[model samples]
Target: MILFKAALATGVLTVGLSASQAAYAAPLSASIQSAATDPRANVKIDSKIQVERTEESASGEITTTLLDPATIKVIPGDKLLFTNAYRNTGGSAVTGFVVNNPVHPAVALTEVLEDWALVSVDGGKSFGKLSDLSVSETASESAPTSRPAQASDVTHIRWVLASPIAPGASGELQFRGIVR
Candidate 1:
């Protein structure tokens, strides 16, 4: 009986020690082999579009006009003008450039796009998405009649340097609009 109890007690003590050790045991960790190895390793190739801007006198003129961004103020039905100018400073001819504008954050673009054209609205983010307003003429109201940016009094203007801006070349795009 004594031997049996001794053996049983040893077994119980071993089990208790193992249970306590297991309670405070370190956790098992597993690593996934196919997990994300690099954060940006799968990134695709990068593309770039070169751009430039400039402006000059119209015809038979030798005067340099000091051009700069204009500050405009008007009511909901008033008109606003935004002019963008650029120059070709590259030796190679360039074509197919794009220009874009968003409703000036300070000026509530949402109000400008409200019904009745009462508010001066222009640019990609103001009235429509940039993708939907592709093409130069599409921006004009004459195209689909969905309030074209071109004919909609064009409260805004952007000049995209399409043609190659021959080295030292200059160009300017001006816009004029009337409020409702």
Candidate 2:
């Protein structure tokens, strides 16, 4: 079982099955792995972040470098690319696998690799595009107005796999975000 916890504007949002539910859940078990800004390894999982950088040579030639994300310090307006790798360590195949990542309140969602994934702007209540989403704008006490969502308004992202993950198989999910 996998659980996700994130801080939002209103409060914290928690998802996934609890320990008690996992005990009584289905027979097939799978693990979800992630890395924040660095790499981690253990008996059950191994995860890492691949940072992309462009540098100019003495000859004015442009080159790209992939480094460890831990070496970088993030600031406002900086963009980050993250890849979450999932390994199926279970004996049986796992189906209907899904991963949900919440965008930190200090940052915003910019791009995602999986086009089929859904985005939520209302603290994960509903998922859709920014133009299709709206929030209650209550600048005054008279009445509340709805306005189109900006990139900063995005709160959560979710991805659902269309195929089952076989035993010993691995997969990846990638996304990009910009600091506010």
Candidate 3:
């Protein structure tokens, strides 16, 4: 019996252990009733939602301030600083994320802090997938706008968390772009 147990622990019989464990650990099954009063099973409340609003003045006058910074007005070839922030408010960690903030038609994306964090030029469509921006060099030519950014333009920068963003934890990404 001792030899059989040892062989079972080390040999192909190991599969039985997993199967037995799974069988023993199987979730307690419950009847799933489709009551007329029951909401859709697939429906779920978004545990996380993004909230954004322009800052307002003391007397309620709307300000042009952008993300606590001055209004962005850049000359051609001038670099503009973009500070992107994100907060995790969900019960679970957000993983494998992608951010897409397209450049305005009048501007281009450039010079991201290389040593600070990862960056992707595909409009945050992918992160850290492309070559890291070199600090000593000028911004990327892809930063220039091929056309004018429209109402649906994505101007915000996206950040991906390499680690778990604990509940209430926030992250920021800063990069530079040029006005075209």
- What TM-score goes with each of the models? 0.29, 0.66, 0.38
**lDDT winner, 2 or 3:** 2
Which candidate order results from sorting by TM-score in descending order?
A: 2, 3, 1
Tens digits of per-residue lDDT, candidate 3, 1-180, equal 000000001121112224333222112121222323321211121211111234578899975432211222223544445444556555555444333333444445555453434443444444442333212222576553344332123333434435655556666555555545
Better of 2 and 3 by TM-score: 2
Q: Write model 2 residue lDDT over 62-87, tens digit each, in one string.
A: 99876553444434555556566777
Score candidate 1 by TM-score against the native: 0.29
Q: Taking the candidates one at a time, how many backbone clashes does each contain?
A: 9, 0, 5
RMSD of each: 29.8, 10.9, 22.3
lDDT tens string, model 1, 21-71?
A: 323211212121221442111111111111112245666556433221111
What is each predicted model's overall lDDT from 0 to 1?
Answer: 0.29, 0.57, 0.35
Lowest lDDT sum, 10 consecutive residues, model 3, at 1-10
lDDT of 2 at 39: 21
Could you tell me how far off, in angstroms, the CA of residue 125 lies in candidate 1 after the best superposition? 8.5
